[model samples]
Target: MPLTAQQLQAWSRQEAAAAQQVTTATQASIWLTLWAAFTGWYSRPQVSDLAARSVRILQPARQQTGGLGAAYVREVLAGLDAVREKAPAINLPAARLGADLEQVYSRPAEAYRLTYALTEDTAAATTAAQERLFTLVRDDLTVARRDGEMLQMRASGVTHYRRIVHPELSATGVCGLCLAAADRLYSVAELLPIHDRCKCTVAPDSDTADEAVSIDLDQLYEDAGGTDGAALKRVRYQVNEHGELGPVLGVEGQKFQRQGDAPKGDPIARARRELAALEPVLDSLESRAAAGEDVAGPLAYQRDRVAKLRAITA
Candidate 1:
């Protein structure tokens, strides 16, 4: 039987958890293959297959990691389904691009990268997939405005491309560039397309536009402020959990609080609370550093936490 919306959500959560486990296992297998290769115990194909399998397993997880935007899509679709159920006589547009929409909403970024990666050796398929994606976005998705290559949508949102191709793909520019553009227009928390060929343009709706803010990456780094730019870079890398990078910021709130002035009132208390939460992690990293052990991963996690804290404080 077809799953209802609630059932689908439940199933999706379960599937997401299971898929995450598989992805982790696959990552372990790849790491093992790397170790085997380093020890001269396996041929190239063995290690390659392990990595490939890991990518395959991680495909769904990576796609779903778009966070709240994916949830929004699911909710919107569910609402549509409810409407259909309540009023059978109500006419609704046939989902001619259902599969394409699913492909987009299910995992826009990874799907684009995966399709590109898989079909690198098959130019025709690559071209076809790209075309298919473009057509769906251009023809099917309700466009609110179009100015040159930039297209804004009423339903799905903004996309910019040199031209449209297929329902499932596009002939747009680099996916990362598209993502960067989307990130500028939408909140980082929002789902942004990450297809290599996606050049979608977007502007926030009237209600959302006031809240929409563009990120200046350089400005952010500048605002972090430190005498040593290299040190700042290292700190960022460490926070991201790069083993090669040394500890940038401690997990403890003490170091962070000392670096920045505390806000007034309850906000200061909240900041301190966050720092308290992070203290143990920071201490662990410090201990590891003193022992000359790699603490990149922990550092990265702490850095991310600190970044979030800073954002909240800001």
Candidate 2:
């Protein structure tokens, strides 16, 4: 069952879409956390406002169609897991099922860094730092989410993957090195995302597609009302109230989510201002600790948060 290149390409596209869903989920959770942190700081400048700092941005969203309060990122991960089971069940390489996927992911950690930095105690309208952080947030999540997808995609087809950077993206030295090395085949482990905001991708070496057998996923597809040798259900990508991806009508009985024309906008500006507002609390905590008071607990916490912010280097 040799699947055509189109089959692999289609699966790749689906995985990419799912990856973007994860990216968007992280972005939204981060944004919401910043909002809450800012509102708390603005309402009452307190050190406790930093509780939103989860070391990993976690905002669990309830599945609108009905389920546990699974966060947006969790949903994507679950959906992807389902997709993985269904996808490779099609005459994909059997070796993939037992693939070692024990690698831990750090997307959430980087996400925390960006979101935590974006939020501070401030009542100001907007600052250059806030704007810069918001602009880069999506790409940051993109790199992280895609790293996970690359691993998943590699499981089905080929162990070796190649790095692909969109030509439109401005290649930094890191990206340049990846692009130059794009033609070389490497193990999936060797090709994890290099750094935050890294926009590179690892693609299956299609030359090995010849070795990929086409498992019959048509039964699974037909059970879901698909036909004509399709592998995945139509209407798999979606957008729900949380501004994260959802399953469209056919799968989730959800109405088609109208895509918003506007880009990620300025409401986030106020969120960043919240981080700026944290300065007062941080300053107080630092001073009390400096003067040698028992403010150790409070000061340690504030320093941890401020250090996360400073990690942004913007």
Residue-wise lDDT of candidate 1 within 29-104, one digit each (tens)?
4335332233111223443443344344434333333222233333333443342211111122232212333333
Q: Whole-model lDDT, candidate 2?
A: 0.37
Model 2 regions more than 4 Å off = 1-14, 36-147, 150-158, 168-178, 208-314
RMSD of candidate 2 to true structure, Å:
17.4
At residue 111, candidate 2 shows an lDDT of 37
Model 1, backbone clash pairs (residues 3+ apart or across chains), number: 27
Off by over 4 Å in 1: 1-42, 66-69, 72-204, 214-223, 226-314
Q: Ten consecutive residues with minimal summed lDDT in candidate 2?
A: 61-70
Which model scores highest in lDDT? 2
- lDDT per residue, candidate 2, 202-313, as tens digits? 4455443322212222122333233322223232322133122211112235453345745344534644565476567778766766788765544455566656555543
Give each model a TM-score: 0.24, 0.36
Give, for candidate 1, the lowest lDDT window spanning 10 residues: 143-152
Error of 1 at 166 (Å): 32
